[model samples]
Target chain A: DAGITQSPRYKITETGRQVTLMCHQTWSHSYMFWYRQDLGHGLRLIYYSAAADITDKGEVPDGYVVSRSKTENFPLTLESATRSQTSVYFCASSKGVPETGTRGYEQYFGPGTRLTVT
Target chain B: AQSVSQHNHHVILSEAASLELGCNYSYGGTVNLFWYVQYPGQHLQLLLKYFSGDPLVKGIKGFEAEFIKSKFSFNLRKPSVQWSDTAEYFCAVNPYGGSQGNLIFGKGTKLSVKP
Candidate 1:
């Protein structure tokens, strides 16, 4: 309730279909990240947002799109899903304190979204 | 690009047995290291972190990690592990200056402690 949460904990969609995974954080953290967990790959970042309307690409951002229209919501969209994209997706949030001159903030993760693309 | 490497992909130990999980990162400069645990059917939670000061960092449930800068390693250890300690453990690194707080995670090690 107070921490980060993801909608549609489990999802199944056909190939070439559009799907969105929603992430919401009540903490109002300035930073939000979307990562995909797959066998042998661990958790690879797909996209991250510094603040509302400020998003950046991560390690594996190809097939995935993310938008943070509001500080509380950062949704990841799959333009046209593929079987390779079937994996557990995780959303993480961290509060940045620029005064520290270093990015030492701890990140909190939400219950992952298990997406199955067929 | 920064990356993390977890040596052990899967580990098995009996109850009360000692536990150790090796983690190494490929980053030249300052970094913030972290250990996260994901219990069965649960979200990933921070087990411990190393920002500065003492290299020996203690975490929840008798878990501890020692950051060895020279070796570019941060290995997690526990004196006595229990059956409840069976879970997936991940080691991550966030490079200090240019990373923008994005973490580079390892492949993770799954620990199974027999009761």
Candidate 2:
């Protein structure tokens, strides 16, 4: 009730079909992020939004698109899904990287959306 | 580009045994270090973090990590581990701000505790 939640926890879609993963946070954090977790690669950032409309690309953003229309929600879309896009995707949020001189900022993570492409 | 490194890919330990997982980073200037844990089928949770003042930081569930600036290492440790302590741990780093907060994560270490 107090943390971030992701929708379509498990999804099965066909290749070339469009899909969207939803993330919503109750914290109303200024920053929201999307990451995909694969077997060998721990977690790779997809896209992140600093605020409502300021979104930036992250590593491995080739086949994904993101839009942040509101502060609480950041949704990631697969315009035309591919077999390679099947992975467990996670969403995260944090205030900032611990002021400026700090070595830490803790981020809250969502349960993650596991997508399977057929 | 900044990158995080986790040397131990998998570890198995008996109950009541001590535990340590290795983590390293390749970044110049300052550093922000973190250790995150993911129990089977659960989301990643923060174990602890090291900011500035102290190198040794304690986290929930009886875990601690020491940040060594010289070797670029932040290793997680537990004096005595329980069976429930089995999980996948990840080390992450973000070099600085003004840059998009892209977290560089290691390959991860999987710890299996035999009860």
Candidate 3:
């Protein structure tokens, strides 16, 4: 109950509609990410936030927008959903990358949101 | 461009059988490698990771992986697997000095262990 979570676990929308997938983590991690899992493509990073008010593009960020107004919340928005945008979206958070002479950190993932665009 | 490769797309095994999944990456310089498992209808969980220490790292659920830097490989192995081990396995890599949250993942291998 204290881990990361995603809202609207399953969603259906028409093309050109707008959809937002919400992610929240109680860990107060400094790094949060959004990834879309697709067949034959695996999981592609779409966006990530280093901390509140700091967001950046990932491998696949053409049609997706993300904002992290709060450290615990990172929401992804599809300005105009397309059929190509329909996929399983996952949110993850991590403390920080291991600095020199420090141990590494692993990410915690959410349940995932399965989005379908018709 | 950096990328991760998982050799198998699907693997079938019987209970108590030995298992190994191959993973490779195409990134120059130092890297962090990880193996993650996803059970049915579940989120991804870290199985093991290799950072800067020993090449052979043991993870949860009797899983272990060896990072062979010369070959750019990290292969997961389990001496004897159970039916409960049936799930999807993913390999990921992050280049050193890159963004902390930038991880390139493999397509994933689905393991089906028959009871």
Fraction of native contacts, model 1: 0.57
Instruction: Write the residue-wise lDDT of candidate 3 on A41-86 in tens digits.
Output: 9899999999999999988899889999999999999999999999
**Distance (Å) between predicted and true CA of B34, model 1?**
0.3
What is the lDDT for A110 in model 2? 96
If you superpose only chain B onto the true chain B, what TM-score does each candidate give? Answer: 0.97, 0.96, 0.97
Output the number of the lDDT-best candidate: 1
Per-residue lDDT of A56-81 in model 1, one digit per residue for the tens?
Answer: 99889999998988999999999999
DockQ of every model listed?
Answer: 0.60, 0.62, 0.63
The list of candidate 1 runs beyond 4 A from truth reads A97-100
What is the C-alpha local distance difference test score of each model? 0.93, 0.90, 0.92
Ranking by lDDT: 1, 3, 2
- Please provide, for model 2 over A35-61, each residue's C-alpha lDDT reduced to its tens digit, 9 standing for 90 to 100: 999998999999988899999999899
Name every residue pair that clashes in candidate 2: A103-B51
Error of 1 at B46 (Å): 0.6
A14 in model 2: Cα distance from truth in Å?
A: 0.5
Q: Per-prediction interface RMSD?
A: 2.4, 2.0, 1.7
Docking class of 1: medium
Error of 1 at A116 (Å): 0.2
